[model samples]
Structure formats: structure tokens, C-alpha cells
Target: MQPLLYNMPTLFAALGIRLKQISRIRQETDDSKPHVVELQQVTAVQVLVKAGQHIRGEPVEDRINSEEVRRLLDEFVPEWEVREERLYRRFETANWRVTLMTANAIGFLSEAAYHHPRLVLNYRSVEVYLTTHDAGGLTKLDFSLARKIEETVGWPRSREEMPGRRPKEWLRS
Candidate 1:
């Protein structure tokens, strides 16, 4: 019984997936805010270093700690074949929280990085790095990685309740 149950992910979704009705994902009307986008009906951001960023996104620190960033790289296990990257790290803490970002969102990140620090864009086939020493010697690679991961896992899949803390349905149109 235990082994069979463990193999079935839906069983966990029954007990694991706990939250509200998750009505719909709405965008904040106020432009003065930090581009607050909702997740429920849409994919809600799981974790934020500063939760308030939800209300008003803070200026991206533009600093990706080496050790910390490496740790996060562990979770986003990018699949070259699917061109999809999943959150491999736990979002329990900022030190360990993984953020995914992408190219299409460069403008937003450009502003977040103060539009100075050069960013590196890596393609699946060829990894590229564009580092600029002018805008304070620091790497914006974290933002790039975050954006990539975010774009890859867009629109969290719709799911119904199940047993354990397992996700059964990630199907989206």
C-alpha cells in the first residue's frame, strides 16, 4: 500500500496541494507599483525575497551571489530537449529561493538593473556572457537566469485535488 501510494503522484496532490479557491490572476492597476501580477488562474510567483515586491517591485539588486546562484542553478535543471526549466531549488528562503527570467523581459530587467550593468544571454546551444565593468563590477547573470526560468515555467498548470503532496495535472492550453 505504501509503495503503491508513493508511486502515484495524484495521491499526494490530494493532501499536498493546499491553498484557496485561487479565483484568478489579476494585474495591479496602479503603475506606481512594481508590476504586481497575480498567479492563481495565472501562475502566481511562489516566493519573493521581499514579499512587498508583489505590491511594488524593488529595484533589482543586480547582485547574484556566486554560492547562492550556484545553489539555485541546481534546481532549475534545464532540459535541453524540452527547452523547459523547472524550479529545482526550494523557495523556502531567499538565500535558497530560485528566480527564473527571460529575454523578452529584458526591458523590465534593464530598468531593474538600473540600465547600466551589461547582461548576458545564453542560448541552449551556445552559452553567452556579456559582462560590463562600468556599472559597478557585478554580474547581472542572476537576473537573466531568473527571467529564463520564469519564462520557461509560464502559466502554472491547472490542477484538481488529490491525495499526498504530489502534482498530477500540469496541463495547460
Candidate 2:
């Protein structure tokens, strides 16, 4: 009897398909001079990995162009500056407590988004820099995180708008 076998690993790799599992298939075979087999059932789960595409069908993140970055900065986040292909901002706090508070806020946002940033903390200031390391440059993730940080830790004068007691100096951009 001749048995037909497939080199599944090699086949899957060549086809750019990731195999999850394959259950046993019931096969029908006839005994004769020439062996013949029929596959009754086959089940498979695979992920197709295409070039510049994620396995889960998510689009690959691309670096933003300089012109696009500039336009984004001008239109939405004028307070942010792009340098060395990174989105950057600095906030001067009233004191060490405010500095730590600002850093904690940024850390929380970064952790929640699963995106991290480079933070330089001083006695009375915090400098934030964001770039997507995997993408090798800034992407939407960086901009979105930066915007969240700004909204969470607003400018020093923003505190004046609060109804209750407010510190004269909280954070200055």
C-alpha cells in the first residue's frame, strides 16, 4: 500500500501560513495493486503572513514623513516639537512633587496603551520623547500618547479655571 504524506512544516513555511493544529482525518483506502486513499474530513486553522502585514490582519505601522509630522504639529499639537525623528515636549513644574506627579501620569498612560516613552525627570521639570521603536520612527501611537499626556497634565494656567482652591503654578509647557 502506498501512503501519501505531506511535509506540513515545509509546505506551510513555503506558503507563508502559520499552522495552529490539524486533527486526525478519517481516511478511506482500497487494497489493490495500486493503492488509493480518499480523505473523508480535514480541518485546519492557519494565519497567512504577508509582506508588510501582520498575522492578525493589522496593517504594519509606518514612519510618518517629515511634512506629515509638521502638519500634524501645526494643526493639532502645536506645543509638540519633532526633532531627531521624535515627538518631544518639556514641562516645567512648580516643584519636585509636581514633577513626580506629571511623570506618574505619563507612565500610567504609557502602560495602559502598551506604548512607552522616554522621560527625563528633573527637580522641577519633565521632558517627554516618543518614538515607535518597532517602526523605527514616530507613528500614530506616539502622537496619541503625547496628546493624552498633555490633556492629563494641562498647562499651569489651566488650574486657574478650576472652581476650588488651585495652586498658582502646577505645570508650565
Candidate 3:
């Protein structure tokens, strides 16, 4: 057999099937073209939702409406904004080390969730742009990942009086 070769995630997403979680990924052999031997799927997570939120379109996995997006931003992720139909957030760090750390943290979260975002890192800041590209706009996945990112990365600065050596000026905005 000529090895099963194709972009599985892209193909499945193009067909309206969202792969929510991935436990791990390991290569089976060390060759010029390494084969992905393991791909594990996990369960879904709960996210904030307003009652009677109408989800339109053929597939329920399609893009979320602007009104709902507005509500989600206002209620859940106030720091994030909608730009050109993508969920956006900018973290202003203290210096280069903080900037790189923030970017890498986001990259780790994005990978674990299997919902990647476009990250732009600078000397003192990192910009995150998220969207369900295959679904064509923002969706539950985007919101969930954003929430996770905030909880993990934003916690140090968000808490009123966190113990330990958490830097006070680690992140801003």
C-alpha cells in the first residue's frame, strides 16, 4: 500500500467535523518522511452560553452569529475583541522574556486544545487572533480556548493577591 497520505484534520474540518481535543502525538519511525503513529481524541468541555441562543446554518458546527459573539465578549472575555470576524486579544508584557513566555504559553494551549490561533509576538507584547477557519468564523472552540488561555496565563495578573513569587507586572492589558 502507498501509505495513507493526506491532511486528516483539514479534510475532516472541511467536512464540518471539529476535532476538539488531542491527548498526544508521536512519530512511529524516524524516516525522511516520518509517519504520525498516534492521534488520540478526547471529550468536550463546557463553556458559557446564553439561554435560547439560536445557532443557524446547515451544520451546527458552523460559525456563531455576531450578536452572540458580542454577548460572549461582553460577558465572558471582556478583554478580547472581534476583528474581521476573528476573536482577538493583545497581551502587553514587561519585556522580551515576558513576551516570548506569553507567546509560548499560548502556543502550548493552542496545541493541546487542537484549536490553533494566529500569534504575533513583539518585543513587549503578543497578539492572538482566533477563528474557526474551516467553519468560517468564531465558534465554541474559539471561545473555549480563549477562556482557557485567560485562566492559565491571565491568572497571575488577574488575582487580587496571589501568593508565592508571582510577579506583579508580569502582564498587562
Candidate 4:
């Protein structure tokens, strides 16, 4: 049997599809954190967020040991809660709770969701966990957010003590 021109075009389309294969997500390295996330053209860095335990992941180690981490935390992150949602504390825009209702962290979690879409957020006694379903583990996004949370809440002691962490600044947030 002979194929028609229309059939010829369809065959070519099929060939194109067959020629392409989806990319896979892979771990990141050399970032000093010792772990990273890169998948299907997406890039993410994994940072460990812990409350107690003193230590675990390499990121935590770096943060404590690295003078850079110390400076960023000391200089950038406000020691007290800010009135806005500018990474210091939860405010009108920076409020994650509200963001959760509206999924404001959508872009934040997009990459994690793309690869392992399944995420389980557990607010434990001391800390919260954000893990990826596809990766079957937690990624840097989780830790980064956790660190943000710590900063947002004024250094992780408690909401009450947050104000004491730093001096009052009307324009802080």
C-alpha cells in the first residue's frame, strides 16, 4: 500500500516525538551544601533546616562555620519581626499562612512539585518539614524556606521572644 501526503506528515510528526525523551531530575553538588536539585531543565539548591539536634546536614555546618553565612544572617535577616512580608516576619504580603490559603509560595514549590510533586508539610514540636514526593526526600527548597521561617519568626526561639531578638524598626519589613 502507498501512503498519502497527509500520512507522510503524520509519520514525520511521530518521528519527532520518538526522537525526544524527557529529561530526568538529578542531585546538585559543588555548591558546598554537598547536595543540590536539578531536574528536567530546572535548578534548585537543597538546604537543611533543623531546630535542635545541633547539626546534621552540610548546609547547617557551612552556615555555622562559613563566615559568609554568619554575615548574611547577621546583616540581611532582621533579628526582629517586620511589619511587612519582606522576609523578616509574617505580615500582610509576607504571611505564609495567608500565602498557603492563596498558595503564594506557588513559585517556591513549583520546582519541587514538578519533579516530585508530592510534598508533605509536617509541623513537628520543634520544627516543620517540607519533603518532595517524587524525590522521596526533602530538597534545598525545604531548608531554604525553613531558614526563611526561622528568620521570619525572629531567630526561632518563639513568637513572643521575636521582638527581643532585634531592635524595633518601623521600616524593617
Candidate 5:
């Protein structure tokens, strides 16, 4: 059996057939079985590092070009601006309390996505700047995370109604 199996590959190659193609055809015949399954799982940090390497090594085709960036700004996130290959947005709240709440929410979203952005917190506002430093410009990750941040914070809301703000009782000294 071992010799036959070893000779099978050589026989297929001699006949101008590919072993991979034969295996794929066999897999297709078995409709009850899954062709792919989850293998070993790694931490989010590892995934981010791999993604950064891929972006750096490959062409910028995956990155959002300037034209699409401008279109996205005009259509969805008008408040966001493009400058020097970065997407910038500033959100104004009614007070410092609201600013903190928004900032925390943005931070959480950034961590969850594994894509960090530059955030500047002010007395009543927060400025967010996003760009793919590895790609040297904007990428879909930046825009997607920005949209998530906007949705998470519900920007432009007043201080009294900012999302994720704890009540006075929940506050610690």
C-alpha cells in the first residue's frame, strides 16, 4: 500500500495531472464534509503584526486611493478631512465630561479593531487622525475603523447625552 501510494504521485505527474487538482476534485465530491476548518488560533497582536507586514510588503492596491477617500468623505463621513494622507475628524461636546466619555469609547473601539489612531482630547472636543503608517497612506482599515468609532460614539451629541457616560454614583473619587 505504501509503495502504491508513493507511485501514485509519480504516475499522475507522468500523465500530466496535478495531485492538488485531484484532491480538490475528491473534496468536491464529498459534499458532507467541510473543505476548510479553523486551525490554531493566535492572539490579536500576532494578527496585527502580520497584517502590518503584509501591507508594508505588498503594493498599495489594498489601500484606499485618494479618489475613493474623497468620495467616502463626501458621502458618509463629511466631518472627516483628508490631509497629508491622513483622515482627520474633530468632535465637539458640551463639556469635559462628555469629551472623556467619547474618548474612552474611541479608545475601546481602536483596541478591538487592532488599528490605533491618533486622538487628541480637549476640554470639550476630541480630534482623531487615522492613516496606515505601514502603507504610507490611507487604507480600508482606517476608514472602516473610523466609521465604527463614529457609530460607537454617536458624534455631535451633547454632553448630557453622550454615549457610555456613567452616572454620578458610578464615578470614583
Candidate 6:
């Protein structure tokens, strides 16, 4: 009799299949209802997987401290803020459409990176706060995501304009 030895790829494939089935079950249960709980769980799992891969050879104590964060911000993301354990930025647009577009860009980037941030969307402003809650502070992931967001949506150059006017011309460019 031979003992079973699971391969990493095989294990991952099996886990992926199980996750798909769970997702399908959630979808089949209710089409109209928002599966917020399930979505959050899946997102969290994805973030964990990504973070695990990212920190495979690194220690959690390597998380960026306030001084390091400030230095990094000064070099690349000067407009961003560091408060306590979080990195924050606010962007304003001229109209609701642009605001929504900016928010969607941030959402897409965050999802792809598996590093979600807190985004508050006002009528013409979007506030983003990034932190590695698991690490209990800022990490390389936070800065990476913030840089992506800055590149994707850019900083607002002017104040909010009329309701229908697009204030941030660079967003269109």
C-alpha cells in the first residue's frame, strides 16, 4: 500500500474547483439578491493568497514604518497622506460621471492587485484609504496599490465644476 502525497498544482486545482462550486451555489440561490457576504469572503481569500505569495520570503515585521512611508510618498506619491497606520488620498472631479469612472478604475485596480482599499465616493470626490489590516499597518502592497490608483485615475487638478461639467480634463485624456 502506498501513502497518498498531494501535489501543489493538484491541490490548487481542487481548491479552485471547490471555490467555483461555492460561487455557483451562491449565484443559484438568488439571482436578484446581492451576495455581498460571499463576495467579501472570496475577496478576502484572494487577498490572502496574493499576500502569501508576495510575502513568501519576507517577514511581516518588514511592513513600512511611518518614516519610510513618508520618504516613499515624498519621492513618488507626495499628495498621499500617512495617518497612524493608513495611507490616504482624496480625488475630486467635476461631475458625478467622472467621479464614478474614477471609482471604477480604483475598484478594478484594487481587485486585480487583490489589495482592496476603502473608497468613499461623494458627488464629486473620492477618498481612498489603504492599509494592510492583517499586517496591522502599511505594507509594500499598500504603496503599490496607491501608485497604481494614481497612475490610473490621476489627481484632480481643479475644484469641482458644474454638475454635468467634467472638471478633470486629464481623466478624459
Write the residue-wise lDDT of candidate 6 on 74-110 in tens digits.
9767779886568899887657877776786677557
Lowest lDDT sum, 10 consecutive residues, model 5, at: 1-10
TM-score of each: 0.25, 0.61, 0.61, 0.23, 0.54, 0.58
User: Stretches of candidate 5 above 4 Å error?
Assistant: 1-61, 156-173
TM-score of candidate 1 against the unseen true structure:
0.25
Total clashes for model 2: 0
lDDT of 4 at 112: 30
85-164, model 4: which lDDT tens digit per residue?
12222322223332332122322333333322222322211122333333333333333544544433223243444345
Better model by lDDT: candidate 3 vs candidate 6: 3
What residue runs in model 4 are displaced by over 4 Å at the alpha carbon?
Answer: 1-39, 44-70, 79-88, 94-98, 101-173
Tens digits of per-residue lDDT for model 5, 66-173: 789988888767767887678998876657876776676677456545567899998877889988776778877677667766655543244455336643312121
Runs in model 3 with CA error above 4 Å? Answer: 1-60, 158-169
lDDT of 1 by residue, 1-173 (tens): 01111122232232232333333222446555333222232111232222212123344344445565455455543321111121121111111111222232333333333332233333221122323233232233333434443443332423332224233222121
| lDDT tens per residue, model 3, 1-173 | 12224344543342233457533344456765544423344122222122112222223355788898989898878878988789998887768877876776677557555566899989988999998776888887788778867765665454354445465446754
The whole-model lDDT of each prediction reads 0.29, 0.62, 0.63, 0.30, 0.58, 0.60
Q: Rank candidates by TM-score, best first.
A: 3, 2, 6, 5, 1, 4
Q: How would you order the candidates by lDDT, starting with the best?
A: 3, 2, 6, 5, 4, 1
- True lDDT of residue 60, candidate 3: 35
